[model samples]
Target: MSRIGKRPVDLPSGVEAKVSGQTVEVKGPKGTRSFTATDDVTLTVDDGKVSVTPRGSSKRAKQQWGMSRTQIANLVTGVSAGFKKELEINGVGYRAQMQGNTLKLNLGYSHEVNFDVPQGVTVTCPKQTEIVVEGADQQLVGQVAANIREWRKPEPYKGKGIKYKDEYIFRKEGKKK
Candidate 1:
């Protein structure tokens, strides 16, 4: 039995969900997001809640059961409260700023790197060393933050790089004679 699949996703006030065939669409104040589930599971919405159930007692069906449920839950949360990701710069010369729709990053490189912001997502640099990504889609927000961090990953030698706000960098011993 799938524990998570059994729990229905409750819709909050001011949020609306519409399930059609294998697709579910959720609309809220932030935005509208939709997901298409596989044929292994069935989706049903009732009483301002959404539920997922497997059609057969099989491995694939059970797997889809939980995954579909979580996907629906994410849609609900995404449309309602939205999502956000924060990044912090740790290097001395590393910094970031917003220029119109583009993000300019200086990560100890010979030249400044320009990052073009994607649609449906908002990137803000409240401080030169801080980056905040916000959007209705959780995956997009997270992916944007990761891409920014990839330019300068935190190293063990000096830990001079970009990283998540709550991330921890393990310090390593320096070379000595």
Candidate 2:
């Protein structure tokens, strides 16, 4: 039995969920999101709750059972409360700023890196060293934050670069002279 799949996802007061075939769609104040589960799982919405169950006892079915349940839960949360990711720039001259729909990043390079914000996700610079990514879709928000951090990953030597706010860098000792 799958622990995550055993629990039904409850729809908040303002959130609504619908099921069609293997697909589940959720709508709330933030936005609307949908997910399609594999044939290994069955999805159903009942009385402001979503449930997932495996179609068989195979290993693949059990795997899909948990994953499908989680995906459906994410859809509900995405539409209701949304998702957010934060990035921190940790270098002397490294900074980020929002220019219209573009994010301008100065990561010690000769030229500035211009990252075009996607349609669904929103990127904001609360401070020069801070970047916040927000969107209704959890995957999109995380992807956008990762793309920004990829420009300059934190180094073990000086720990300088873009990184998640909760991330910790493992520092390496310097070579002896």
Candidate 3:
């Protein structure tokens, strides 16, 4: 049995889960999310708890089953407590700001990059160099953060670019004159 799959997921208060067919819908204070279990995986909700089991004994099936369960659990937690990602600008002229529903970023480019913020997610710049992204969907939040980071990944030579607030990028020394 899979250790993570064997553990039951505890549903928090104010969060409601409904299992209909192969799709599981989770509703909470933040928002609602739904996920479908694979054919080799089965999920059930009982008394505010969720359980996942494999439909077959094959190794691949078991792996899918465990992954399905983890995805469902993350969805439940995300809707209940939400998710957050913090980013920091390292370049000299790099900065970010919120304008209406869009996030405009200046990453030393000739023109600014404007990213549209999707519904159910919020992006804020607490400080000039700090950015915070929050949402009820874990996947969406993470994807957005990744997209932002992709604009200007940290360079190994100078460690200058956009990166996660807690992320560390190793720097290499420049050539001697």
Candidate 4:
């Protein structure tokens, strides 16, 4: 049995969800997000909650059961409270700032890298070493943060690069004399 699949996703007060065939759409104060699941699972909405069930007892159906349920739950949480990802710069010359709809990053490179912020997502820099990405869609917010971090990934030795707020850098021993 699928433990997670059995639990229905409860809709918040201001959030609403609609299940049509294999597609689920959720609307809230932040924005509207939708997902289309595979045929292996069935989506149902009732009594201010949404549920997912497998169409059959096959292996694929069972695999999708729990996955579909979590997807629906993400949709609910995303629309209601939205999502965010924070990045921290750890290098001396590395810094970030916002310019209109663009993000200016100085990650020890000879030239400052300009990152264009996409629509539906908001990128902000409260400080030179901090970057915050916020949006209704969790995937888009995470992707934007990843793209920004790609310019200067954190290194294991000096750890001078961009990294997540809660991420830990595993230190390695230097060369022996």
lDDT of 3 by residue, 20-96 (tens): 98899999998889998878878889988988888889998889877988898899889888899999999888999
**In candidate 4, how many clashes are counted?**
0
| Candidate 3 local Cα displacement, residue 60, angstroms | 3.0
Query: Model-by-model lDDT, in order?
Result: 0.93, 0.93, 0.90, 0.92
TM-scores for candidates 1 onward, in order: 0.97, 0.96, 0.94, 0.96
The best candidate by lDDT is: 2
Top candidate when judged by TM-score against the true structure: 1
Residue 81, candidate 3: alpha-carbon lDDT: 88
Q: Taking the tens digit of each residue's C-alpha lDDT, what string does model 4 give over 44-70?
A: 999999999899899999999999899
Worst 10 residues of 3 by lDDT: 60-69
Candidate 3 local lDDT, residue 62: 83
Off by over 4 Å in 3: none
Error of 1 at 127 (Å): 1.0
Q: Write the per-residue lDDT of candidate 1 for residues 26-105, one digit (tens) a residue.
A: 99999899999999999888999998999999999999999999988988888888899999998888899999999999
Instruction: Assess the local accuracy of residue 119 in candidate 3 as a C-alpha lDDT between 0 and 100.
Output: 80
Badly placed stretches (over 4 Å) of model 4 are none
Please provide, for model 2 over 12-126, each residue's C-alpha lDDT reduced to its tens digit, 9 standing for 90 to 100: 9999998999888888999888888999999888888899999989999999999999988888888888899999999999999999999999999999999999999999999
Clashing pairs in 3: none
Tell me how candidate 2 scores on lDDT: 0.93
Clashing pairs in 4: none
Clashing pairs in 2: none
